[model samples]
Target: MVPRVPSPRRPRLPSGRAADAALAAVVLVLVAVGSLRSLIGERQESWETTALAWALLVAACAALYACRRHPVPTATFVLAATIAYYLVSAYDGPLLVAFVVALYTVAAEGRLRMAILLAALGLLLTGAGTLLGNHDVNGVALFMMTGWLVGVVALGWVRENRLALAREAEQRAASEERLRIARELHDVVGHHISLINVQSAAALRRLRKDPEGGPERAEEALGAIKDASREALRELRTTLGVLRQVDESAPTAPVAGLDRLGDLAAAARRTGLDVRVSTDGERRRLPAEVDLAAYRIVQESLTNVTRHAQATAVTVRTEHGPRHLTVEVTDNGRGPIPLGGGSGSGITGMRERARALGGELTTGPTLNGGFTVRATLPCPAAPLAHLPGPGSAMANGEPPRP
Candidate 1:
């Protein structure tokens, strides 16, 4: 199996408040020195008048520090200071900078509806004030205000859209987890329950024939039932452990691997099936997850044979390659054999396990009047690793054949 790529860490952004302090300091210098108007226009106003403008500009810019914590109130204070300076002062460099930043914060952090209403109200008030005072409204003033206001709102909208998409992705991941857990519960319990039913019916028939010998047969049936119950509970607890929040001191049970196949085959033999197992190449170790998946496929296949297939013989085979491994389980059963028919949920589950590892599974009725399940699982390695092609002979040097 290919190892999963680790997720990247989120990028860290510099604090906006740190930048705000610098911006506020720059605004203070420009307004106090009265040098801003030299670039925009000549500031012929007196030093006393410039000092008043400086006071209002400083108040507006200072409020920016609190915009994130109390966005609406801080923005309102900045707006009032801007209007006071706009109405009387000849310079507007610092006030304009503070005004745009405050509006963006209001939209980003606080109630959006209130921010929108305030923006519209300020626009109308500025237009009306300009008209009443007969100031020029068709020059650089109109274009600058329009661009600055619209840019702030657009940035806030983009941020909101990204947050919405992130929330939706988290919800979808949660739903998929629920479906996965449900499928695990079904597979673990369903096979054991099927075995229990078959054993119980046989015991009933024996009991109705002779009371003395019947007790012995019934005792055997109860023993099988107890074993099945314990197995189901153990597997359920092991699989469902992921859902618990509490930490555990007990060690987790190791997952079942291909090494347990001998015991599995022996169990099937007890259930009246003559089973055989064979390997085609060097039996090197597999990736942990791939080994577990192969074991489950073999176990499920044998359970299907006992529950559905009427035949008395079966075969389990494995072929190991340098870059991949193939597993097959075949039984002499009739076509469309219940859950083991190679077309129901059981086959779908097997295919899912293979596909998750970039592999595939195919199931069909063999020409020998039985059903066959075959799966190929991949193993990933570095680019430098040399592996033989599919048509090449095994490491044993035998000629390749289909």
Candidate 2:
């Protein structure tokens, strides 16, 4: 036996809280070391003033740990601690790093207005305190600080907007996947289940008519039922397998398309309905999505006829154009077609499938008191050289009467 290959494991990253704590620790060390350099240099400040500055610098850095969770409060605390540290220390340190991080968190948390107000307030308070202390801040120094404050807040705001857009896109993808699964299950299970119901009913009717002779007829119906169930199970397994597939690198099994219309027609014929399938225009390979949509529309139309339409005859037609494929299913059933053009979810699903592929579907009572489902789908195949006109000899594939 071949050796099984293990899947590659994804690298794990630090969680939000752990990352925040790590950031705070790094900031504390950097600020503490940078501020302590003042002691080695010539310093006129007293020992008490130096000790107070170190404590405040550590508090400012530590506040970063709670920045994301309580952004506004953390920003306010860090701002106060940084301001106090600057007032007490003779030399400026990198304590502004923690203040910048806090302001960014505030904006990143979607508190944009508050973050801006806090940023402006920090600049104003720092300038005022520097002036009152008889220490004039140079024009260039104030300009650089203002630039840093504005840049960090703007960056945080951009991050928030990006995160919002990402969430919206993720939600849309999940919703579309749900709809796709619902449509697939309806088409796969609904069609075969309806056929099984009809065959089973026919089998029961045969047995009731003639107990002894009915065995042969009932057996045929039973065989048809078995076939329908097996097909249903097979299609269901394929759909569920796709949903459960963890490895996208593996080859995907092909789904039913227009090529499987023969199988679909065979299943429908078992219900004693004259299901005739005909094609118009050039017949060639179509895009996978288009093929699947066309097949499902036909499958659902046939299913509706089998379950609801009491008519004995139905025609399935596919018209191919250079860039378009039109599918029509008409049944000579006397069943009432909902005035709204859709009786239930099956019709709705068929219309959705067509629309999803930039196509359209129409369902209504045909002029001859029959129900009809028609869909127009865009195909990427080459255009047909000659498309049949309204007065064409074989319009809609129906033979012309001589």
Candidate 3:
């Protein structure tokens, strides 16, 4: 399951028109507050021109406020109003603020062609006052307009990338979990079913041959089948329980791993196959993830033997080294085609289990007339060794986090 991220709530009016209207009112108030000193001062220009300029600035801000929703149109309106204001009066305060905001929105939200067109219009209007009316060339005004416009657009793009990365991480985590669950289900069901099939067929043949003592022997086979089915279903339920609501108060059992290898070998022997397990070096506890993955790989390989190999004898060997643990499974039966010949579920599942723990697996027909599967799993010196005694929080893996 993917974890959710919380976002801050922003204020907005219900309808588009109302939202624009409310924004316009706030912009008007700000303009009035900022221009109060000059509004009641000695009239440098006629009241008619002054009132017209004020109206133009208000119009520019009202349009700028909707730049997020209507980028191209709002930018055009702001450009027209700014040029009109400068043409009518010499006074320039926060009047250019709206124009810059609108330009930024166009760069951030509009298509490339449209953004280029709006940018061209912005430059043309900056020189409009000089061309259409009396005004001096001002480099300061040009710099301020260009800088703010570029800055905010870059800011918006950065925000977009960060959000995308977060979503990608969530998806990767979910996909990995799904793969893991699938592997578990396959190993459990495949192993149980193969044993059941082998035992049931044997019982049927024994009954056909010997009329007496047939019921007693067949009863034993049925009992073994029932046990295998029950165990398989119980494990399936445990694996599926993770998808349900979890309660902290209810303790959960640990996953089966090397500790259950004896049970696995016993089940195989019950199917009349001679199975043997051999280990080397000192054996100790492994990280839960590594342990579970190793167990699944071995389990899948043996299940393949019971189903396809028809081998009378099977051998599993585990070797623990300083840096890695190796597992090998071999059976003396006529080998099937190599795993890569098709989408063989046993080989595919085994490979996935090893790779999930930053390890590798290989499978092929053994020269001695059978199939063999081998895998290697790395072992860290300690679980949290890289972490600074108590405070380090960075998660580690072979490849860096995306």
What Cα-based lDDT does every candidate model obtain? 0.71, 0.85, 0.73
If both were scored by lDDT, which would come out higher, candidate 1 or candidate 3? 3
Clashing pairs in 2: 322-383
Which runs of model 1 end up more than 4 angstroms from their true locations? 1-144, 209-211, 250-253, 337-344, 381-402
Summed over model 1, clashes come to 0
- Across 1-402, the per-residue lDDT of candidate 1 in tens digits comes to 999999999977546777667656665665555536633456567777777766777788788777777788888888888888876676545456677777887777636776777677677777777678737454367667777787786677567667777888999888767756665666677667766776777678779987889989787776776776777787777776757856755545556676666656655665557788776665666788888788778877877777777768888888777788888999998744555435446666777778877888998898989999898999643332243421233321244578
lDDT of 2 at 220: 90
lDDT comparing candidate 1 with the true structure: 0.71
TM-score pick, better of 1 and 3: 3
Identify the runs in model 3 with alpha carbons over 4 angstroms from their true place.
1-32, 35-70, 73-95, 105-117, 131-137, 196-212, 248-254, 337-343, 381-402
For candidate 3, which ten residues in a row score worst on lDDT?
A: 389-398
Ranking by TM-score: 2, 3, 1
TM-score, per-candidate, Cα-based: 0.62, 0.87, 0.74
TM-score, predicted candidate 2 vs. hidden true structure: 0.87
| Of 1 and 2, the candidate ranking higher by lDDT | 2
